[model samples]
Every structure is written in structure tokens, then in C-alpha cells.
Target: MCCLRRKKNKQGQYQELISVVPSVPGHSAPVIPVSQGFCARHGEIPFSLPPRCVPQNTAVLRDAERQEKEKEGAMKVDAQRDILAHRGSLSVGSWYPVGSVLTGLYSMTPLSEVVAPPLGMATRLCFSVEYRHSSEQLVVSLLRLSNLLPRFHSNMTLVELRLLPDDRRPRQAKARGTGPDPEFNDCLIFQVSAVCVLRSTLSVCVLSVEKDGKRHAVGRVLFPLEGELGQAGRVLWRDLDPEEETQCSELGDVQISLSYSSSLQRLSLVVLGARGLQLLTDAGVCVQVSLQIHTQMVKTKRSCVVEGEQDPIFNYRMTFKLRPQHLDDACLRFELQHPNDNRSEPPALLGVLVLGPFMYARGLQLQHWMDMINKAQEPVRMWHRLGRAI
Candidate 1:
């Protein structure tokens, strides 16, 4: 009888194989015949590369596919490059005289990201200067505010912008409404310099913000903001015909006045939100702020004091300084906080609220300042060399 040999399995089950006895000393090897069980586990063996993962042929296919993908990517890049080339290089970082900046650089809104509707909304801007400069310079480009144009798509407008030392004219541009920010649809240059102070102002006439007029958290011309910020708004308290929260533009010269009344006081501004007034203290630090809520009837006779949560309009005035890095560029941030409202709203007005680098309030003219920087105390090197040659 033929000997049916079996192979041992870990599970104690036997796998069959053919056993052959040879006459030669070492020819007793068993050969398995071609049968159903012989090739049962076709794909069970483990291998390094993936199945059909051919290195040479698959690599060639992969490389070709990769090349095709790269070519497609190149087309997209080329299209963008062509678009950029069509639009000449933009001048952005050049420093220029404070006076040369557009009158109203729109302080546009980041309304786009939070709500999608207010994204690219145009914002107003204004800067107040109270000093002068010894030397200053001006830098400008044709496309300063191009990034914020998608929403309004309006060519830059110098809406009610202001600059320093105007003829001291009776023009109500300075104290009245303000200009827009650079991010607004307008590309207006709002810079000024003078004997007393240089202030820059910017404004955007229209913006594409989401929300109906009167109750709109920031209204139509909403400026975007971040973190905690302070905002001041004119409120009609005690006697109300249209009592609900109304925007500054809706109030239309309703007499809103903010001042640092206390002598040597750190009166930081706080936005009176729905829950309560949030004091914008120094960034990243918890500061104990002392506040005094009073009435400034400068713009109106309906004077009402500010308190805490119970009253939104008559809330105590709070003030704190944000670290330089966290200081917002807006004069007035959101006055109220709606849970859904991200603090990305810019101030209603644009331009530097705090007198900055070249303003007279801070120092002096930008051009003279640049002169001081680029000017040489000694003779020019080229002139000195010529003199030595002589």
C-alpha cells in the first residue's frame, strides 16, 4: 500500500502530501500533485509591497500618473501667475508721508468669515493726531487696499477722510462721521501731518454686511474685530420712541461723546454687551479696572448714567489698555455682544484711532522723519572720493 503522508498544522489538523521513497540515497523528497488543496490559499502569503503594487511597472505607472497630476497643478499655477502678471506688481510696504495717505482708508470688516454674509463688508476709518514731526516720509502704492475689495467691489473712495492742518476750514469732516479702513472696498489714503496734530481718516460708503438696518449688531458699515474690545455708542434712555438698540448711523448725530474724565486715570473702554459690559483690559492679563459712569450732555440733553447688567444703555464706564500687540486699530468696537456675533467687527470709523507713528500728536511729519533716517550728517561718500581725486 502507498504511504499517505500528512503535514502537521498548529491546530492539530493534518494537511496531505505525497510521500515518495527513492532508490538513491537522498531522493526521498515528497512532491505534492496539482490538486484543489495544493493551491488553496492563493493570496494568503504576506509580501512587502501591496498586491498589484508593482515597483517597476507600477512605479512607472505611478510616476506617469504623478507627472500628469503635476502638469495639471502647473496649469492652475500658470493661470494664477498670468492673472498676477496682467495685474502689475503691487506696492504695499513703502513708507510715505502721513499727509500723502488717502483721506479715508476704509477699515473694512472680517464679517466674511464668521457669518459669510458680512465678509468683505466695507468699514469706515479715522485717525486723530495731536502732535508734529521733525522729519517724516511718505510711501504709497496704487493698490494699497486690494484684499478687501471682493465684497463691495467699489473702487477706493476717500469718503470723508481727514488730514492734519487743513486750512482750519469750517468743514465738519473731522468731528463728524469718519473714513473707512484699508480693508474696506475703498483704497483711499487717509493721512495727515501739521503744526499741531496729524490725523488720518477713511470711510466706505456702502458694505455688504448681513443683517437688517436698525437692529443689526454692527449695522451695514460694520468693521470687523477680535478678542475683547471697547466700543461707544449713543443710546436713548429714559424716554424711548424707538427704544430698542439702534446703530450710530441710525441715530444720525444723536450726540455720542466719550472722554477720559479722570485725571491721570486709565479709563479703558468696554463694550456693553447683552450679558454685561466686558472691560477690555490689558491683553492676556486680568486687570482690576475702576470706572465712573457719568453723563456728558455735550451732544444731547437726554443725559442718563451707566450701570451694570440691568441697564444696557446706562452701564458703568470701564477702561483698560490692551498690550501693544493686542490693541485694536478701531476707535469703537462692537457695542453689544450677540452670542453668535464673533468679535471680528471693526469700529464704525476707520483710520488710526490712537495717534500713530507720524501723527503730530505722537510726534511729527513722516517725510522729515524719513529724512532724518536717510540723511547723512557727513558729506556723501561719492563727493568725498571726488574731492580726494582733485
Candidate 2:
């Protein structure tokens, strides 16, 4: 039989109510029932279930990777096309994209061939001139050079002074500066005779020296000494004339007579004389003439040495045996040489002259050669200008 029971709270009020079943003497506890056939075949089921395995699709991933590679290849091809289009147009300081890398940063323009224009500048010279009666010497002072044009490469410059007709000795002074205007506070002195002082003129030339030891005349100016400035020196400025227009007095001039004999197969060349030869010292100077066929020198002759003379006379003659056929390829080279004081050093070359056919000659030199050929046995005499060694 069942019975109801009531409990009291701490506040003296009825709290919980319960129903209880009365137990009989010697009774057991209650148990839950289960199916015996299912329990024997399988284990008991778990409260939660495990997740299932699923297969993945790889084709979609491969397609996406191929598309990415194609995009990269297209970008590379476009970069190469742009580089080819610009090519040499890219300046050294500018930057541009090369393939996938950024090279320089500037505009991309098509490259084209360009030619550099010839550069030239008007030059001026500042100098002072004076003649000392007591010393019987002419003095030239080079102050400075202005408006000099910069060369494509670095070079050395010097000023050369010569007292014309009477004194042809070259006196040079080196200039020093880092800019277009150079300073040359240097003096040059030349001995002058009383009779020739009034008639003498000062020839000034500016020469540029290269690394190969070759000298080129840049410009020149001529100053006469007839005025009162010869007694009391005066500073003056003069405009330099172009090398082509101005006559180079330092190189001097040579007179020669050429004749050929067809029957004897002989060529006769006479070394008459040379005047206005510019020398660095009072040493003896001689003229050496050589006959060259093609590249080999066949014969050579030299004139007598003359000392202390601006104009030297040499009546020496030379003859070369050659056939008419060889004339087309024959060339004559004349060199002016002076002995050096020091035995250790070689002889110095003053000037040179080359005469031959059109291939080896020009201007007066060519004209002289043609006249010798046209006139045959008749002697053709002409004056030729001397120049630095080729």
C-alpha cells in the first residue's frame, strides 16, 4: 500500500510533499528489462555517432594552376615586346622594366641614329712685347689665353713665339689652368740684331699636344715690332685666326726642282734651299730625303747641315733609277732633322714633307707631282710648305 508524507521547512512552513510505497517483509529491488536476442548479437549503441569520410575533386585545382601559369607567361611576353620596342632609346640615367624586373625609371622612346656636330670656339690671346736695346734681345710675355674650347678629350696647350725673318728659333711657354681660360705668366727671349729689329715681326702660335706626342696648331697671330712699343713694352690682346686661314710660319717653306728622264729611266730631284725654318736652338739642321716604293724605302740622301741660319741653301742633288711603271706607286719623303746635344738622346725631327700621286699627296704637293709627269724631261720647280711629321 502507498502512503503520503509531509516535511517542514526551517521557517516552520510546510516545504516538500512526497508519496512512498510501504515495503513488505523480505521484498527485492525493481530491475529494467532488455531484449536478450539483440543483446547477444551486437554491442550496446554509443551516445554520439562518428563522422563519415568523403572523396575530393583534383581536376578543379589543376585547371586553376594552369590558368595562373598562362597569366605569368603572357606578362613575360609583353615585357619583352616593350623592351624591344624601346631598345637603345633608353638613356643611361633612365629606368624601365626588363622582363619581370624594373631597370631604370624614365620614358620609353624608339631609338634612332644620331650624328654629333663639329664643335669650335673663338679664341683670344693676351701678351706683351718689348725689345731691349741694351741686351739686343726681343722679349715676349704670354699672360693668358681666353675662350678656349674644350676638346673631346684632355690635352696640354703651349704658346710658341718666333721672331720672323731674322730669328726663327721657337720659344715656348706652357700654360696652367683647369678651365677654358688658362694663365701663362711666362716669358720668352730671342736675340735680335740692330739692323733686323725694325723689320722683324713676332709670330705667335697656340699648339695642343696629345697623349701620343703629336702637336696640332690651334690658332695663330702675327705682331709687328715697328711701332714705339718695341722700346717700351706694351700689353695687347689679339684675336686668334683659324688654323686653315693662317699661314704657319714655324713650319717654313722648301723649294725643289723635279725632272724625269724616260729614256734613262732615272728621276732627278734637286734640293735647292729652305727658308723661314723655325728651330728650337742654334744647332745645325739638315734635310733627309727618302724614296719609297709602296712600303719599302729604296734610296735615301741627305743635304749639308747649316748653322745659325733661318734660311739655308742646299744645292745637293739625288737621282733614283726606276722604270715608268714604278712611278705610279713611288713616294718621296723629306724630313728635317737636328742633332741633339746629349748623346743619350736621338736626333730631333723638325718637319716633314710627303710628295706622291693622288693617293699620297694633296694641294701644292699633288700639283707638283702632276707637273713632273706632264712635262717629262723638263724641270718643274715649286715651293712647298713643311709640316709636322705625319
| lDDT on C-alpha atoms for all candidate structures | 0.27, 0.72
TM-score for each candidate, following the candidate numbering: 0.18, 0.37
Q: Which stretches of candidate 2 lie over 4 Å from their true place?
A: 1-248, 341-344
Model 2 worst lDDT run, 10 consecutive residues: 110-119
Top-lDDT candidate index: 2
lDDT assessment of candidate 2: 0.72
Query: Per-residue lDDT tens digits of candidate 2, residues 213-294?
Result: 6656677787877874644656677888754554545788777889889889998998888778887788888889999999
